[model samples]
Target: MLDLFTIFSKGGIVLWYFQSTSQIFTPSVNALIRSVILQERTGNHSYEHDSLRLQYKLDNEFELIFVVAYQKILQLSYVDKFLNDIHLEFRDRFKNELQSSQWFSDYTFKKSYDNILVAAENWGKAQAKLPKQMRTFDESFKSKKTVASMIERKDDKDNKKQEGKCLFTLVGKKKKGTNGTDDDLISSQEVLQVEAPKPVQNVNGDVFEDPLMMNRIKLAQKFSGQKKKADKQKSPKPEKAGKKPRVWELGGTNKDLATLERTKDKPEDEGDYIGADTTLIGKMKGGIQDLEVESDSVEESDEVEEIVEVNKSPVQKKSGGMLSMFKSLVGNKSLKHEDMLPVLDKLKDHLIAKNVASDIATKLCDSVATKLEGKILGTFESVANTVKATLTEALVQILSPKRRVDILRDAFEAKKHGRPYVMAFCGVNGVGKSTNLAKICFWLIENNFRVLIAACDTFRAGAVEQLRTHMRHLNALHPAEKHDNQTMVQLYEKGYGKDAAGIAMEAIRFAKESRFDIVLVDTAGRMQDNEPLMRALTKLIRVNEPDLVLFVGEALVGNEAVDQLVKFNQALADYSSSNDPHIIDGIVLTKFDTIDDKVGAAISMTYITGQPIVFVGTGQTYTDLKSLNAKAVVHALMK
Candidate 1:
């Protein structure tokens, strides 16, 4: 018996297929076979593996007819005749539909073609039962009537009815019992159903009879009884008398001030140091509100001294006391490398947890440690505060770029020169290259520059259509104020299966001729590992060098973004002959809001690549692009 049959067009696209009930070829296997045949360009061949055989015939038009069957049952002549008939019928029937590329999902066409395969299977079966002398192809299936016969029509109908019965049974409908009569199968009248049993009631009127529910009720009651008994066993203790609140002595009283004045006039001694509690160091730790020191009495001095209001709550007081104690212990000692080791370790762990590359985290920690060694500690300084200050300064220094491109200014300058400021966006697949390109277009339009989006992403299936959708949305949201179609925000697509580089070159020419200020070229998404695709991207850049090449990537990719940028830059350098070698001038991080806690991507990417992030995609809108803020990113990481 013929087990599997498939047909393919000249370009290796599947046109139609059929499978027998015994064994079927997987879609992937079918695609593999098609790719092999298309690549090898075999005319007619038979391949055997184990007990199965795969035979295919290529027609004059390069259309493939493939059949998979068991080796023992194979009759080459009969199979060849069947294939010829199928090809003739398919070409004659689907002639008009095959001329277009959009006829893959025609349901009526599929149904009519499927019936022909049924008739062929039926004819094969009938020929198998005949004597050897009478088994000629012409004798068995010469007439049109014979070719139109179907043996599985009744079986197909019965299968559909059984499917309906299974669906009804699944959805709580009553099924026909084994002893059901013919009337039972045909009747549509409603049958009276039995009512469910009433649940048993307990003494407390709880009506649940399910065993699991009964067990839960018993367990809850047991826990509640134990909780009540435990609560009764505890007794209240007598409250202790509260201590008097400590008063903070800012300056002395009037009498003490006068005595201090009298003593100041009397003599000078070497042993006149104040105690730790009354010194300036103690006041700093308690959070200084005010401080005053005078040798004259309050009446004599015209300046009225403001007193510091200390916290009265015991917890606050206790915390203040602990701070004072710590300050006194470490006030005079210089910070050693040993003192900061624990803090640096913790900082390294924090950076790694936030998705910073492991090596980058180590470098950051080492940098901070180098700056902190042999540093003097003030009375109120703590290790955590020092580490934060050092880390912030280091990150800010790393994130600050040496050269920055003001896109708006560049566009205005290009317009003054009567040329368009072109920027090409590239990235790995599904990283939102096209959407972010549209975002940049919207940004340019808002900045008073006439913009055009070039939909040069022709490799992917629906790349052109996706760009068109974006253009329509952007036009609807922010329509051009004063311009014709040439100058307004328009999409230029050469459609799919065309050379992307050629499309981009033409787009730039179009922009120059149309006098647009900026042209944003969107390229197809490809993986960094795909050398052929990456080389094509490099060619696109080399042929028509854009003013800026920005790498668009996902923030959630973390350290992997670093690898992508590096490899892309290397590819551009290796392929392009330009003196400046097409490197990523900037990065646009997409889905920035999705990576809630892992925010080290921005820091790691900037630090590793030395490329500043230009804008971040925060939401799905034209106006959702936000300029990168270094302080905000640092704060988020530290938080």
Candidate 2:
């Protein structure tokens, strides 16, 4: 066989020559190395004759520049161009690596060959700045006859030759086995290729020089002169030529984060996905096999040379052993700065119970991780404190604790004991009093309550309109409309009543006369301080006092107003005689539609008077109103 250098080098005398020179333009980094840089070092020597010798040294920056120039100069190539060239040049090296590694697990010869071709393409891209002569030599074989032959094939003639200028030019006739060619020379299998690139022009007339892209690759190279950089700074590789395979290098936190909890902008519910590409997994597994093979070879041969070179490759840095990575997390407070899965699990239900969001629950879990080591618990007090602080802040931004509690408590109580047979709703104007009343009517119906609604609110046209809309919701839930009649109400001192006392007398007289099993009185939320109104209400109590009085108040009014209601009604709890009247028996926290808030929710906490919050208004929709449960409120605030 001819020396590899003789085949590669552009210096050879094909005695009795029938020379044929083929020029191929390829985008490959390997093809980039085959570029003929004919510099005019001599000024007009015998009509400007400059010998085309080779420059041996190049930096990564130069390689990147060459890569850019190659793309611009080379025509689009596939098939027997870049891939075939790499295969012809490298030959059995990559082929052997393919069979040894079993790169394509399906393990067909065609697939393995393609995979090896792809890996070379990727390697070509990585070493894009390598000097042309040094690429093949430094690439795999060092100081071999291939390198020598690559440097000296056939010396170029003077300017008269102008070889490879137009098409596949015939440099000369072939030699016979590194000797003089006989007369009848047949086709030769191996031919030297030096790509004579045409100057390609873009539409803008300016070359697309990717300087940042070039610099990025330069910085990524393993040189002592360079400072270390974050993985995010690495440059993106250029696209491979057609039919050329390229390696997939997953870098950067967003792509190759080791932890399961990745904030990759995918949906929060997508679950843990850590380096889950089958092709990538196979590549990783191949590396492991390589390590195992090396380990076995070392044990058998007692080879110290192989062991010394282990740390030379970037693989040593990247191939973090799974066991070692786990060990690192053991004594650390966090793994990938993430809380344990168990902590998140416990916090999740706790937050849900407290009325917190999934995202906040997750944050709470992270905060807990700050106070712990692997498999160990954070302080019970710290955990509680953190959860409470986070949840309190969250709830204050959303809804009040006391109001939410009362709303939940009452609804739960009602649900537990039995949906209310006789329940009343009370609240101020625009406090969603009537709307909440409609909600209760709907909830009772949804829960299969024999609900009976009385539209005794004979004032506020919007209130009546709002309630009518809510009645539709109630009707849908119950499959039967609540019986409502306005004539049964004795509101506004209208028609025929003697005075306030007489009007109150007839209001109660008429409500019972209706003989309803469930009676929900929609009284006016005019004033808690009004004496005449209170007197009239007292008259109703004397006549046919209702079973429950759910005094409604605006929850967004915050703790101060809630305190007023609780204080006022709770004070009335002591009243027994006709002179001293019971003002408010229980509370229905209202106006939940305008606020899903924190300061607003905390403000309602001032009304923490042990009064069971029977109902809550959540949204403008009657369906939005949810009954507050105390336990649920406590969990929401803490978790």
Clash count (model 2, backbone only): 52
TM-score of each: 0.48, 0.31
The TM-score between candidate 1 and the true structure equals 0.48
Model 2 CA lDDT for position 148: 57
Off by over 4 Å in 1: 1-336, 478-487
Candidate 2 overall lDDT versus native:
0.39
How well is each residue in 366-441 modelled by candidate 1, as lDDT tens digits? 6566455546667766755666677877776666664776887787788889899999999999989888887777
What's the count of clashing pairs in each model shown?
0, 52
For candidate 1, the clash count comes to: 0
Task: State the lDDT of candidate 2 residue by residue for 1-639, as single tens digits.
Answer: 000011121222211101123323122323323221121111111110121211121111111110111222232223223334433433343345544863432234345445644665556665565665635544555555464556633444434356424332334455565555474343444332323334446898965534454454454332223444453476889988688566568534565455645543332354322221122111211001100001111111211111124557422222222111111113322232243444346545644443333443454444334223222323332222333344344433322322222322454455465443345455444555666666555444444334445554555455444444445444433332243522211122232223433443444444445432244556555455665544444444444455566767675553246445644454444333555554555566666444433212422332233344555665554345555544344432441
Residue 125 error, candidate 1, Å: 91
